[model samples]
Target: MFDINGGELIVLFVVAALVIGPQRLPAYAEQLAVLVRRGREWISQARTRLDEETGDLGVDWEALDPRKYDPRRIVRDALLDEPSTARRAAASAVVGIPPAASAPLVGPAPYDDEAT
Candidate 1:
């Protein structure tokens, strides 16, 4: 997320080495690693507690992902029932209209530049 490259990492290491000195750098690094591990553990515990409190109910944990959690997926899934989606597709097929042509445009068409 920070977009740190090899050169940036080298620079960071050099600066840390200078500031903390070679003898103490390893100790500091160890402490930092421990803190990061603890933080991750705390976050996982909190998520577990929240999930327990909510009782999951009918929610599918298999489909749930912490890294890619999206609230909209729940709403979209609720709206687009499998049978209704199939019925809509079948109705559209009977009308001989391509599904892509029925979708709404979010903005002006790309070819508008050429037209102008």
Candidate 2:
């Protein structure tokens, strides 16, 4: 994220080595590793808690993958929940669409210059 390249990394290592000294570098590295491990454990615990809460609500926690945590995916899934007429009517109401229309009115579209 910081965009540190190989040269910058080498410089950072040199600076760290100098400031921390050779003897204390290993100790500091070990402490840093421990902190990273603890942070990961905390994240895992939080995820587990979230999973439990979702499961209690009858949600499939396994279906909720972190990599697929896109707002578009959530919206699409909500929209495609049911193919039945009654469910579609309910969905249309939720989305502020009139049940008589096949598509929702979203205001006038811009004229396509290339179409002519």
Candidate 3:
């Protein structure tokens, strides 16, 4: 993300070594690693908590994905309804049954011998 290259990294190491001295550089590096790790953990925890809180609200996370926001994808999805949903609606119309009432068509067995 930082776009740092190998040359830049070597320069940074040399400068750090000169400024911090070889004596304490390893210790400082370890501390930096620990700080970075902790920051990652904190960020992960925050994301998990946010997801959990939103889970109950029936949010469609895929709809919120940045990649799906492309204008082409948006237009495509808008112009073409999901094929399965369209078929289900058509079946309901032909059968004179509401979509909910036809849930058994898509779901597991609705009538069990034990229930009968």
Candidate 4:
């Protein structure tokens, strides 16, 4: 997340080594690792607590998941409700793209061995 490249990491290491000194660098590095681990644990605990509190209020956690923003899911949900012809025609007027002649089939097509 910090986006530190190899060169940046080397620079950070050199600075830490110079400032902290070679004699104590390993000990300091170990301490830093432990601090980071503890911080992560605290964050996870906070997230769990928040989720539990929100769950009491009946939130749908799956909908909050960022990975669920799949294009297929979005388009499928939008198409499930059949809009009237007037709405469909007006939609293109706002966006300036021609409406489809017809909606495409939502799922897998029938096998066509003849095409293969």
Error of 1 at 104 (Å): 27
Off by over 4 Å in 3: 1-3, 56-116
lDDT of 1 at 105: 45
Model 2, residue pairs in steric clash: none
lDDT of 4 by residue, 4-72 (tens): 999999998899799999899889889999999999999999999997887777677798888876888
Q: How many backbone clashes does candidate 3 have?
A: 0
Off by over 4 Å in 4: 1-4, 56-116
Q: Write one digit per residue (lDDT tens) for candidate 2, span 15-96.
A: 9999999999999999999999999999999999998887777776667978768899788786656467887688889988
* Model 1 steric clash total: 0
What does candidate 3's lDDT look like per residue over 18-114, in tens digits? 9999899999999999999999999999999998887778778799988767998777675564457778788999999988876533434367779
Q: What is the C-alpha RMSD of each candidate to the true structure, in Å?
A: 12.0, 8.6, 14.5, 10.6
Worst lDDT run of 10 residues, candidate 1, spans 100-109
In each prediction, how many residue pairs overlap at the backbone (N, C-alpha, C within less than 3 A)?
0, 0, 0, 0
Alpha-carbon TM-score of each model against the true structure:
0.46, 0.47, 0.49, 0.47
Q: What is the lDDT of residue 8 in candidate 2?
A: 94
List, residue by residue over 1-116, the lDDT tens digit for candidate 1: 99999999999989989999989988999999999999999999999999899885997776776867787987777555444555656766888867665444455446755664
Stretches of model 2 off by over 4 angstroms after superposition: 56-116
TM-score, prediction 2: 0.47
Model 3's TM-score against the true structure: 0.49
lDDT of each: 0.79, 0.84, 0.84, 0.83
